[model samples]
Target chain A: MAKDNLLGGSLWDAYSNKVTTLMNNPQHQGEITEEEAAAHGNKLIVADFGAESCGDAVRLYWEINPETDVIENAKFKSFGCGTAIASSDVMTELCMGKTVDEAVKITNIDVEKALRDDPDTPAVPPQKMHCSVMAYDVIKKAAGLYKGVDAESFEEDIIVCECARVSLSTLQEVIRLNDLKTIEEITDYTKAGGFCKSCIKPGGHEEREYYLVDILADTRRQMDEEKMAAAADASMTGDFENMTLVQQIKAIDAVIDESVRQFLVMDGGNMEVIDIKNSDDNIDVYIRYLGACNGCASSTTGTLYAIESTLKEKLSQKIRVLPI
Target chain B: MQVYMDNNATTMTDPKVVEAMLPFFSERYGNPNSLHKFGTSVHLPLSKAIDQVYKGINASDGDDIVFTSCATEANNWVLQSVWIDNVLNSDKNHILTTEVEHPSILSTCKFLEEQGMKVTYLPVNDQGIVEAHTVRSFITDKTALVSIMWANNETGMIFPIQEIGEICKEKGVLFHTDGVQAVGKIPVDMQSVHVDFMSMSAHKFHGPKGIGALYIRDSQPLTPLFHGGEQMGGRRSGTLNVPGIIGMGRALELATENIEATMALIRSKRDRLEDALLEMLDDVMVVGERDNRTPNTILISVRGVEGEGMLWDLNNALIGASTGSACASEDLEANTVMLAIGADNELAHTGIRLSLSRFTTDEEVDYVIEAFTAAVKRLRAISSSYAKVGPSPGGEAQACDLLYHHDNDIVVKH
Candidate 1:
């Protein structure tokens, strides 16, 4: 019979062929008995972990060669959705030949990528992404049990995403390397704040010590400061005093557009350079406030000070920003 | 062998119903409101279809049956119209309903509550059923309406609609029932029930989708859901869905014919399937008493196995089923009926509903029983909670040998 039933199409279609096949007939679905471990002169380790969010649990069994700390055989029993079963299956397979120390290095992304039938398509749907995270956690749990330590001790770095086990340093490094501007781009790169998004902001499933929003904002700010410093060094060689009035106005406008305009625009305000006059020893740049900035109380005090200081720092030391 | 047991969601459209609707789409296609002979010729069959609906529910000529898009629209129309007619115009400002009602009724009541209406959501017992006395105790003189479902879509537990309807009639409050899951599967007599309004969907009983009707007793005064062309006696206004009405009418006619015998066959198959599952699997339970539920439905919860896991295994074997898990739902919230019935949070995610139809065969039921037993065995072996042995000694492992206590039945196996 054809499997073209009305609703059954979408349920199985959400998974790839590899995941579906592994979920049905997982190769390593049994446990490693203590007798079998004794025969091989190995240590038998059983680690059980449960996800409270979806009531899914997994028990990982490992037969590690005691002499070399190498995992000779690994198996898992998963009591969750099909995606979790397939994930645990692949996770156990990936831990087979690696040493106990090397097995701890395996991440959820590696398990999910191994389950993918194609390179581009995801192994499971987005909602089921937490299954691979469960796989990653159970490995840590098994490693922890064998090593006689807490499972969290395996993570040496400051973990930012508990769901994906992504560390703060990894998120920062990925953000800096990719020049990621949005949280979606960060998720695409590191999968931080992807599942159970309590780490993304203040109000989510739980309060977190670190949030992706703050991290992204802080990283972007640092990137901006680095760019400004490099541009300031390059602009120092260009003499503002020898340039014509048009060149002076253009330089001031460039500085304002790069630095001051973003802050003002964020507050629903803007400014335009009207003219630049070289008076006495100071270069006065006349500006007009537009939109919500027109006739504002801060236009003369705080806003004027910020514009003037930014121009002095970025363009030249003698430039004065006057709001006309 | 493809077996479909998710009739509570929707059933395969009956070929006889499809045959009845085919001509109205092309050869007999005519707007009933047109002034020409092509339009006037349709009134005979239209009235026959209306008469068939009236007979399906044992309604009288004095009553009104307004066709709508589906049962959801009919439910919304009844609640919102009562909010306008009774709550806004009169001093009555309260509505009573059960917590286990379909989202259409629950969400509409929620919208009314936001609009300053006092609504009471009565709770169900562990069997997932609402008693009639519960409805009576919540009614006050300020009550405008009492809305309840004739049967639960999840557990198939039939509510006491007759008793609740009698209480509403005595209290002088309007009573409505979402009869979407009850109409063709069971005998619904509007005359004996004292129900003022009832909503039903045709697709639930093998009719084509996108068509349903609302039964209004004595053509009672209520505001219309739509305005414009004066169709449905000005109670609901729009161009009539000619083919949908024809299909629904024929489907209901066939469903009601020899209904007891057909349901008896389906009931035996449902009972056999249920018994086989309970006897074959450990820690598996039916959600409600078989005597209390519709004859063709079973909601079973297998401990240690998630609902989606069972669905995936069964779907692979060419069997279609449904689950009460929020993970399986689009809204991603736990099943409200399971929660309202006081199931433990974990057990609530394990509910899987299988509804049989008259078209379901005995061979299909046997296949499902075998498939379901195999799925339970295969899934439980991998389950962390269904551990048959304790942890190895001195292993420092968190033992997963769990003792599940349910209804004074200790499910502890060494």
Candidate 2:
């Protein structure tokens, strides 16, 4: 149900959606019903080869059918993220169909190989294969139902950080909610990339990709408007060096767009060029203000003097200029 | 629509106290500070009133009492007297107080610490009570004072002040207990233990606001809180508020006269209200050691709702109460006292303090209970996620599944 909610209200909603989607997918969904899951009879088999103890493996155990395991069950387990979770998840599935002999054969190598087929998987490490195989053996032995000799009974997953489960979903949620655009932001938010600094090194995953259809459309529209405006400017006022200050003001006023009009309207005023006069080789713009600006106390403020100075700076005086 | 449950902040002036104040405010108003026959006549009643307050607290000597504007002022005068005396000129610079004490004591200790004094904050147990032994552990030869509140304003949890006072006496340390909430509601005697000072406010027990008294033991040397024209025996300054003093004295007299009957009635109402709330709502924790609480006060934290919003709803329905400490109501960092007592963030946010008086009737109790239940339900319905976790009336349960047998079929649904 949560998976159907694409645009969630909060970041937690996004997490719920992702978790729900992972649970519903048939591959990760083990072949067992919840009613069959009994807590007492079956031995507690943990898949600790994952990232950390609290994250993916624990979540998988919570979502998976408890009754499905014949002897291997995740009463306790741990994992890191992405591949480690996929590895443990794959190990859990492989254990469901086989007896103790065939189940123990499913190692980290097999889990990693199996995860390559999953759409969520990016890359796999060779050492994770050893972790998966060792964890599987431990689970078989811990259950006490497996008739085999193994190194350890329970899976060997170490709890590095306890504050956040620091598993796959935890880091993913942190990244998504915080909008971590840089590795520094990710490290600051999750603290996963900070500690031990093993799996979370830079370039471990490619930069997230976003679709740019809106960006392209906006760029094209802006370019077209700019081209038309430039064409009009070239045709109306090609050369302004030799024109008188009055003629120059008329040329510039012709191109005064709606932006200036809207800006003046926002200030409860408007402007019209009354005269452009020359004074001692400088051009001054004389403008008649309308509405509030015409009789306003601050009329002489930059509104008139700044405009005249800016015009002089842009178009050098052909002769003396002054405001009328 | 004013629903004020911030009674600990200050109660509405009692009508009886108001009536007593009116006559003094107009006619019969003479300067108690003056030396004339009219002044003496006013002074006579004022002297009798101070004696009455002294008797109310079971003080042996009348001279031990001093009337102040309010409890905070009394507490300040009592604690700051040590500083003014310059008594600890050579040694004894440490002041010990509990972590859950009111700001009057806590902030005063902090201020004293800034003045080259050491302050040891005794930690409290989960119940917000500092053991007498803990207070002793913080005391040393240099310890100047040990100040603890008589009853917590937020939870109404009574501290073992008698035992603490004995310990302070044994250590030769001055003990100043803030008895603002305890003086009128409960029996307090300044002479019973070797307490050097204690503070009380009239409003907590039905007097007008801005009037209180400080019980200063004669055995302890005291310096005036202010220097002025020989008022309040040169211990406190400024013109005496003759009307306010008379009203406070009267309030104390009234509270003590009906203390037993008032306690029984409020205890019954409080118990019934608490029982109803706990039975109706799950995950509600009654704060403090319930058995040791004052009869008229109940501090509870309701899960899955904001206390401020719940208080607003209760106020709309004319039910008065407070959340956290009345002084800390505006702060959202969660009650520091609640946190000091080991309450979680959720409990701190949802804490509601219900303090009743003799005026709380049986009908008001039932109305409050009903209003509280309705408010919790209403707030929960509007919350972002909790609305999904609880079963509304006519809805299925939220926790787990149930099975039903229908004719020839069986069905199970979560």
Candidate 3:
């Protein structure tokens, strides 16, 4: 690949796209009207923390803020992910300079409710309430006061969810509302995984492939090669609809073997069939090289592709070719 | 916290090395180029440092160690010196190198080829090991020099340099080995190997970058790559990168002192990681020869996933590893090393290189395995073809959406 195709334009252009969206969003800029500032007094400081990928802090910030209360000298900095960052930036403008007491009362719920009401913004994950709560906590802390008794340890209150800043309580709330069943679901609800993509998946399976129940047993049953050879030898096993899984694998293998042999033999090389393992959907085969391919740089690429492309055309889409 | 795993790219300067170099930049700053007593006094530590590096490599007393701005410069001096400067540049000029050789060698070979030199690219086996015979076969009568790497940067594959050098010597041709990645990490004795020239980069083995040495055996009267007033015993001329040179000496000494224990620790960790990852991801393939590979390095590929994406996800999780080097990331090409070892490009792209150092801890190793497993599983989830048939509902749909869309809204709810 060329450098341009790889870098996809300079990182400068990517940064520009991000900055342009930030500068454009009115909600992100917030309504910094003098009247609004005067009405809010010093209670308003914009607690602009991230939501989603930021996790607990953003949530806790939002949770602390129940309403769109203002705070004095209120500006927040966050280089958070996408819409969440923009939302936090907008939320900051919305809450600037009312008073400390007022700002502490605002919550992620209010911000999300506001986001949902705004047509331009996408659906705010129920979890984003945590971000607003985080913003509220920041305002309260900055003011050196708390409306509620300081029962939780600072570490306890400090959420670990830096992306969305969703607090422990906020995560629980979002989880309950969405009936999230897995860590993936939990991530979707609270946006704890929006940034790093660290939402733990169920189990440790490197791949999770789904098959319709009816086809699975049938595919597994077709593993025997004599049965597959019979099916491939049968003239009616067309397009693999009537063929067994083993038959399809063999058919694909036959095509690949022929193609690989043709290409390699032409190049003073030959391919060795290493191993074939049958799975429900695909047969994985590993190949070794003989002749020119043993030292050739283009052997794996050119020779393997010749094999794979030939197999892909002969077999159903399910068949895959792998190299040793 | 910012984690640095790209040590192969360049290491953070050791604070001790920094402290030692500080005075030379300030009050004690007298150019060694000067003839004054102040300059002459500075020569004591500088010469001692040079001796330290020489001692670390176990070079003979007669061997001439010449420092350069970097290993690249040193390599250029050793390689192109015989050709361009020493009157060996001709169509008959032949340079032999292993397929897994670094860009410094590869690019240099490319430049030499453009200048009409007949270059022979030696092939490495599936283990990334180049046999001695491979060099022997390429050694024509016109072969000027055979350049083979002491240790590969990506796969950490050690070559049979001594055997190659012995063969070249038998043929009466000069031999040069790039020992940049090998020097401090393993035992190297130039007196025993009897090679003409070898290049070592300070940074690759934990020294500071921008300073390296070219060990020219006493027998070879090589022409200078750079010519100027008295410097490097008139072999080359330039102001010394004093701090970088001093740092190299200290780094090499420290690394040599603990090489055995450090390698043992790395080998244990590397084996554990490889075994754990292989067990978790059953279909995954380990690259390079297990026995022949560097103890500190493990290169493995999880089938059906882009190594770059997997690496990004790992970094995002605060676990540092790479598809190859921090330098090679810009290319996004599959591992040329893996491809040379007969892995297809897809498999090569899926390759991940993990290098451990003396500084790497058991906890870090465990974290690496955990992080790698998690990230590989996650990235594999979005690799549509594999997930399509494997038994997870909606995996294909999720992977498809991830592939085609700017917004992962269909899959990631937020």
In terms of DockQ, the best-performing candidate is: 1
**By TM-score, who's the top model here?**
1
lDDT by residue for model 3 over A1-324, one digit each (tens)? 687577454311232232235423323322233344446442222222222111111211211232543344433333222233334555555555544455445555454444453545433332223334444444444433333333132334444354355555565556445545455555666666453222222111111122112122333344345456666656364655346655555655576566557777787987766665667777566677788878688866765666766766665455455665
Candidate 2 runs further than 4 Å off: A1-324, B1-6, B86-88, B325-331, B384-414
lDDT at residue B362 of model 3 (Cα atoms): 72
TM-score computed on alpha carbons, candidate 2: 0.53
TM-score for each candidate, following the candidate numbering: 0.78, 0.53, 0.54
- Please list the residue runs of candidate 3 whose C-alpha ends up more than 4 Å from where it truly belongs after superposition: A1-324, B1-3, B85-91, B325-333, B389-414
Ranking by TM-score: 1, 3, 2
Candidate 1 structure quality by residue, lDDT tens digits, B80-127: 999999999999999988878999998998899889998888878888
Reference-based lDDT, each prediction: 0.84, 0.59, 0.59
Model 3 residue B400 lDDT score: 11
lDDT of 2 at A322: 32
Ranking by DockQ: 1, 2, 3
How much is the lDDT of residue B59 in candidate 1?
A: 99
Each candidate's clash count: 0, 21, 72
- List native contact recovery per candidate, as a fraction of 1: 0.31, 0.00, 0.00
